[model samples]
Structure formats: structure tokens, C-alpha cells
Target: IDPRKTETAEIASAHHFIVPGSDAYLLLAMLQLMFERDWVNAGHLAPLLQGVETVRELVAPFTLALAQERTGISAAVIEAMTEKLVQTPRAVFYGRMGVSVQEYGALCQWAIQLINLLAGNVDVVGGALVPNSAAGYVKPGERGAGHFNRFQSRVSGLPEFGGELPATVMAEEMLTPGEGQIRAMLTLAGNPVLSAPSGQQLDQAFEGLDFMVSMDIYINETTRHADYILPPTSALEHDHYDFAFHRLAVRNTARYNEPVFEPEAGALHDWEILNQLSQKLGDHKGIDVKMFPAPSAIVDQSLQQGPYGKHNQRGDDALDLAALREHPHGIDLGPLTPSLPQRLCNEEKNIRLVWQGIADDIERLRIASPPQQQGKLLLIGRRHVRSNNSWMHNSHRLVKGKPRWRCLMNSKDMHEHKLADGDDIVISSRAGEVQTEVEQSDDVMPGVVCLPHGWG
Candidate 1:
């Protein structure tokens, strides 16, 4: 479900128009119905689950009626969908940007997992399968394998995730005074000024930094303020492995690639630049650059130690970097299978159905009324294939299409506001305003408007 009639929605068997920020309510209501109808079923995973009863109690107030009121989706529709979920075999409920980037993002994620669990689908055939990814297969009970809250941002006390503060907090961390203040920055392959929350604020925050270095190909919106720009070899000039994204693939697969084109003389790879900088900064202030391992070596080691690797007793069938390299396309590691209790990172080898933070967040949603939509259009972001990446602005071949950066207003909304297609208009919010040409499209929900996300 999405505010706009996306292409995916067009091809979908069913599509529901959901208010931009109210998906958590729908999730909560679905859980409530599942509990009420006694449809809660985790199958074999029941033994590993905890706090089902507590979740039931917390979600009681977020009934179908309440969810309908909040999400702009009808009560009957929500109820029917909930029933369908229970009746369907091996059903899975997944959400993306709409579920996240909302007030209850973390809560929504927890609820989605809960829905899959209660549907008796976790780690089962035809259901969600936890694959032993060759690129990133962490063993069960591995220390620090999904740990959280070890520390927080020094300025706003925002909890850190994987030892990194949220991008939303970066501006505040730099602007805030006193201890642990940010005086320098080293940006790499990111454009926080245009992409991050409170982006305009980051513009000011960046100007105040004592020293700023950017390791990027383009002096785009974020990197323009850098005192020094380090241009590294492009992806075309670098050997790559899908080390990060392969873990997220639906099926287990391994692919290794060699650079099709060699780098020009006097050019440096990103790792080489970083290594040299590390050496210049001294041992105490930087990583041991002299002993730094190349990315290929790391990938080789990971493959060697992996399940399908040389270390495995599986003989000739074992996989390694060399074996992966043999297949220029990719090696299919086979379909996803039930790797459950072993797939879990915790020593408990169980899925806790509850978290105190989520419970409290649900309470807030229960008491708080949905934000009044009258006289206020919910602004949603969109992206096009041609211009989604700001760095591609310089690519004439990619950006030489119809202009995509325009305000898309629902036809009814345009009529009510006495505006027309191609009319120059100003979109305003509590934070700020932007001027863009408006285009009428009945494809969007009446109270929702959209703007392509790119280059501020």
C-alpha cells in the first residue's frame, strides 16, 4: 500500500491507498484482530517466542475501527485483509519506506515480524526463510551479532545503532556546544545535506565545521562545502563483490566481479586513499594502514570460513573466492531453507515477541488521535529511475529525460486549491517551503502530494 498509485501497485493483484504515516496503526490493528480471533500461530517457533500475551494486551486499544480512522483505509477492508492473512497459506507481510520513516518506524518493523510469526510462517518452507548467506552468515550465539544501545550520540543522547549515530542527528551533533562536539567530518559516497532529515539544518551545520573532507566523485550538494575533495576510482575501475546486498537477496547466491576497465595512471582507489590518510594520521589516530588487507583478501577469507567454504567438510562442493570467480555471472547457492534457531543471533536462540519500548510506543498511538488531515496535505516523496541519484545529474545520458522534479498534486486537490497543471506553486510545511511547478495526477490520494527526492 502507498499514497501514490505506484507502478508496483498498478501490477499488484490488490492495492490499498494508505495514509503516508499511519501504517503502524494498521499493523497494530491487524495484530489485535489476530489475537482476538485466536489466529495466533507460530507453529514450531512457539517455544522460542516470548510476550505474545503482553503484545495482545498492548494492541487491544488499536482496534480495526481505530486503524481505519487513522489510516484512511476502511474498517471492513482492514478486517477482510486481517482475515485473509489468517486464511492464506504461508502469508508474509512486508513493508518498506512507508513502514519506516514514520513516527513509529521501529514499532512498525517489530509488528511486521510479529505478523509473520503469528501466521505460523517463520523459518518454514513457502514462508520467510532465513538463508545462510555466503557473504554474511553469522553463527548463532555470536557475540555482538545484533547488539544495540551500547552507546549514544554525545550531543542529543540519541541511541547508536552498530556504533553509528543516526544521520538525522548529525546536524545537531555538530551544532550543539560543549563536550564531544564535532569539529571535523570525513564524508564518503553520501549526500546527507540533500537526503537526510532536517537537511536544510545540515547546510548550516556543515559550514561551521573546522575541517571537512569528502571522498566522492562529485561535488554535489553535500560535498560542495568540503575543504578537500578526494576523487577515487569509479565502480567501472574497481573490482567488486556484492558483499553487502547479497545477504538481503531472497535466495542465497554468491557473485564476484573483476573491473572491466583499468584505472588511469595517477588515479587512486578509495581504499588506497584511506590507507594513505591513516598512515599520515599516525598509529594512535588512525587504523594500521601498512597492515590493511585489501577488500579481495577480506572476501576471500570470508568465503574460506563460510558454510560452503574450503573449511567445510563438504569436499569438492565447497565454495571459495576462486570458485565464485569461476562463474562470471553468479553461483546459485540454492533456495532459502529453514535455518531458524541457528539463524538467530542471540544466545537465547529465541524470538522475543515483546520489547518494552514498543509496548510504550503502542500506548502513545492508542491515546493519541491521528493528525487532522483537513487543510493540510500529507507530503510524500517519490523517485524516478533517471534522476534518483543526485550524482547522476552530470550524466547527460541518464538525466536527459522529461523533467522529473515537479510537485504532483491529486486532481481533486488541484481543483480545490484553484490550481492547474504546470502552475508554479509553493509547497509549505512547518519546517519550510519549496517552490516547484505543480502537475495534476488523479493517481495520488486526494489529500496526498508528492515530490521527487533528489538534489534538494
Candidate 2:
């Protein structure tokens, strides 16, 4: 956990959070605890934070016991963690990929942000800071809601990057017939079929697409569905500047990688390949300027703007093209300043903790009082940094032999299911079922089960 992103000096003065699988249940408990003990920092709240009163009223019924029952976490532990979170002056709550790929993934992400808001960490230093990369731009682009929010998936209503969501919906779009049925797809450095929900269903959906293209190194699970595959050069062959990673980096640091190999006669770099593709695609219709700006023009302008560029230095930014050329390793920007009074992509120049879309969805889920299923094993996914999926399975160093695949069932649940460790058992959900070997571990909660991803 990076302190720069998690430290806030407002409500609780401390930072804390729970693991992914436990988020939904534990977060509700934290909110309930805050309300129960009057831990909510009412004085620190912004006026636009909606449903605070409604949330207070709603959490009344969800007592500690109820939370423990739903989430399989002990009430005593939840109480302790809640207290720790509120006791410190600058704390942040953080969750990443682990929390964003489940059934309640979005809800969990929203909840983490809510906790940060309730703690008054928004916009403060040592708290989650917004990106300052906007200052480094040339020609000063008008920054506001661009045309990126209008386009959505024809089937599942997923928004595009400009308006469409992640290409995870590529499979669903293929099977669903309507406007924008997705006759073709262009995949870049992604494998959705194995990594996305309902992989089997996604596999079938890809068959429906008229054409599929992939820009990748090796043909993996998703690439098998493509009509044409464009193999790009390996990482070593290209110079690297991680623009996105910089904005998201916890600490202010910069590093650049130089190409190890000299350019061959006809070989193109990734940027060159992308630029050529954009020109062929015509007009940059669905492309974002941030991603595909006219490289030559941008470079020329950047050269004129000086090293740090026009955005960061206002024509005085120390960074200029000559400096960059001299120092190819990159320059560190150093620790960022506290952005407590600054706006982070917000129109009002403040964080929108409880936005309209999120607040409305929470309210709907609150009123539904949906039925909970029994005898269902919660299947959670796990992976190591060394390997992402079956694509890396062939690497002997990463995966020795079929990854240690098994459903981590608590010893108590193991007995309840009349199952033994290493026994073949059928794990089923309402949607479907698969046979997985069982591995009993005391670390798993009584009702919870852990499953390694990419069984196929």
C-alpha cells in the first residue's frame, strides 16, 4: 500500500481496509459501525454527498451480527478494524484488480471510495491524489467531458472508453444482435476469453463476430478466435515510457527504457505500428487524441515547449527535448504536493464521493432485499504475479505443471459437504458447474471457498 495514495488528514486520521472477497460484507459492517458509534465525520462532509441520511437509516437494521452472518467475518474483528481505520489522521483505503472482477466488484470499488470519503481523505495530501499529467500537455486542450461517454455496448449497455467500457463485453456483443453488433474486433495486448466472466460463453460469442484481429506476441486463448494476428516486437526491441503508470504511481518517480536492438530495414516500432494502423483506420473516429495524437506534430511541439513541456512548466518547465535526449533514463518528478484544495478531474474541483450513478445504484440494491442463496460455495479467483493465465502456463519457471488448482474450502465446510482434501468434487453455481479438486485450508472462512483461475 502506497502511503501517498492512502494517507488523509481528516475524519479518522487513519487508513485501513479488508481483502477482496470480504469487502461487500466487511464494508457494510464498517458503515454500520460508523453509524452505530457515531464515527461518521459529519462536519467534514461536502454538501453534494447525497443519501447520507438515507444510508444512516438503512444501515440501522444491519447490525454486527447480521454483517458477520452475511460476510462470514467475525463481528469482533470488524469492530477492531473499524476502530483502527478511524483513529489515524492520514489514512487511505485502497483496492485494485482483486476487488474489481467479481459479481459485486463495482459495488466493492464504490464502497472503498465511500470509506475514503467518509474519512474526509478526498483531495488531501497523503490521500488519493489526482493526476497532474494534464499540466504537461502542449497547445492546451480543453479538458472536460469529451465525447467519450456517449457510446455504449449495444447489448449490455457497457460504456466505451470515450463512452464504451472495456472490451470484456466483446463476447457478449458478438452474440447479441442489435445496432452495433460488432462485426469486427481489434484486440491489443488483451485476452478476454480466459480472463473475463463466463469464459465458455465468451468463446461462443466470438464465433458470431464476422472478423477479429489481434496485435499480440503469442496466440493465446482469445487469439484463437481472431481472423488475423499481428505479432508485435518483444518488449526489449522498443523504447518504453509508461505514461499511464506514471499517473497511477503511488510515488512520484520516472523511468524510461531504451531499445536494445537497432531498427531493422523494414521493422516498425509499436508506436509506428499503431500510427500506421490509425491512418489506415481513417479519421481516428473512435480513437482518443491522448492515445493517438499526430506523433510528428506533437513531438515538434513538445520540442518547442521545453523539457517538462508546456503543460507542466507553462513554457518554463525545466524539461525540454534536449534534456530528454541527454537523459534517456527519464527524470523523477519527486514527491507530489498535497492536493487538498485541488480538483481531480471534477467539474467542481472537488472529489465526488457519492455521485449520481453510484448513489442511485446503491439505493436500488438497498431497497431490493434480494434473496441469498444457500449451499452455494463462493468461488474466488487467485493468481501470482509471475503468470496471468493459461498463456503463461507454458513457462516452466512460472508454472511447473498444471497450476496448484483446487477449491480452498475451510475444514469445517469440508466436513459439511462430506468431502475430503484432494477429493474430486462438483462445484456448481446457478449458472453452471465444474469439477474441481478440493484443498482444505483453515485460512479460508467456514462458508468461503478459493478457486484458482484458468482451469482450462
- Maximum-TM-score candidate: 1
- After best superposition, candidate 1 residue 439: deviation in angstroms? 1.5
lDDT of 1 at 64: 89
User: Among all windows of ten consecutive residues in candidate 2, which has the lowest summed lDDT?
Assistant: 1-10
Q: Which stretches of candidate 1 lie over 4 Å from their true place?
A: 283-290, 389-391
TM-score of each: 0.95, 0.77
> Model 2, stretches more than 4 Å misplaced?
1-22, 42-65, 123-126, 130-152, 157-162, 166-168, 177-179, 263-265, 281-317, 320-330, 344-347, 368-371, 394-397, 417-422, 430-436
For residue 338, model 2's alpha carbon misses the true position, in angstroms, by 1.1
Q: Per-residue lDDT tens digits of candidate 2, residues 179-227?
A: 7776888888777777766777777877667898888877777888899
Residue-by-residue lDDT tens digits, candidate 1, 155-183:
67788777777887899889999888998
Error of 1 at 21 (Å): 0.8
Instruction: Rate residue 369 of model 1 by lDDT.
Output: 66
In TM-score terms, candidate 1 sits at: 0.95
Q: lDDT scores for all predictions?
A: 0.84, 0.63
